[model samples]
Target: MSFRSEPFLWIHLAGLAVLPLFLELTWLGLAIAESLVPVWLELILLAIVGIVPIAWMQWQKPFDIFSLLFVALQPQQLTSQQRQILRLFKTRKHRVLTLFAVLAMGWALWKLAVFAPLAAPAAARLTQSRGLGLGLAIVGFLGSNLFLQVPISVLGVLLTSNGQFEVTEPLTPEEVSQSVTVLGFRVGNILPTVASNNL
Candidate 1:
């Protein structure tokens, strides 16, 4: 096969060089390297399958229309403070979101590492046997679900802070004064009412 026809030859070779990353714990590094062919093939196939729906959706609408929808439904209207908030959100870790994401991904990565050794021999056995291959494929299918959570969570964080705010535009002095008065009245209402309790 010509190198040009191998869409993922480079990626496969690169994965080989970096396989040790998954093998960081020396004793747990017992990978049946030969068995990785089916796993890697499944990864490629899954990527294409996953991308097709997104591609179709985008193709159904001009991207500018999608952008317009995004803008219209966005929680806040665009303003200078919103723009600054968005920039801050993009560059900084929303600690609550990032903490949960990292914890979840870290757990999955740990499980993958722990199971890698046990999976190696089964992977080897499956490569040579048809029924076993089907079973392994089912296992691979189930395992892929765990890998998808991280990306989904990341997308959630990105959408939340799409950066629109009311503070950026200047408010008239009269408007500010009215707001202060309303806020002061609202604050004063919080005290306990002795007459109501006596009744």
Candidate 2:
């Protein structure tokens, strides 16, 4: 929490952030290479792309995820309300990033899934260069990850929140805990809440 430890904190976060980026790049690279090479080469490259980060992640967050998994798996004395309270914590969205990501993924999926299926026989006549297919595939795969990032971040937030004790209130603690009313009918609470001792 002090100024001196901030550098180390950011350094670790920076390293963790780099992991997903490498994965996205590797996936897109594989996609581009899919149509160009033999199966064995593809498999070897895929293994390298996938396994290395997982090993790194194991080093980074080795104990935490496993312990959480165990806590979640076995039946516990957790109240039903306590369980619902956990779902309140969600990732905040970035409009610009979300829009750009959607556009990229939509374009990529169209080119790969829709156009490729329709253009199969005509591909030979259409592509002037041998590399176009690979190019499109790479773009498509990367685009998939682009749109996927927000959702993945949301998941990561949820996973990490599970270990925490604080619960944030968007408006006020009182209103947040109150049941939401819609047009005269009580629908439900905006979000469930946990103890505010940490907050």
Per-prediction TM-score, please? 0.26, 0.28
RMSD of each: 19.6, 15.6
Q: Name the best candidate (by lDDT).
A: 2
Q: Model 2, range 146-190, lDDT digits (tens) per residue?
A: 225334333333344433424433323233233211112222221
TM-score of the candidate numbered 1? 0.26
lDDT, each prediction: 0.32, 0.33
Candidate 2: where are CA atoms >4 Å away? 1-36, 42-125, 158-199
Q: Measured by TM-score, how close is model 2 to the native structure?
A: 0.28
Error of 1 at 173 (Å): 30
lDDT (Cα, 0-100) at 116 in candidate 2? 41
Per-residue lDDT over 1-199 for candidate 1, one digit per residue giving the tens place of the 0 to 100 score: 2211221222222333332332232112223343455645643443344333333222232111101111221212222332333232222343343345334533544455446667665455434543444344334433333223223323333344323322223333333322211111212112134212321
lDDT of 1 at 190: 21
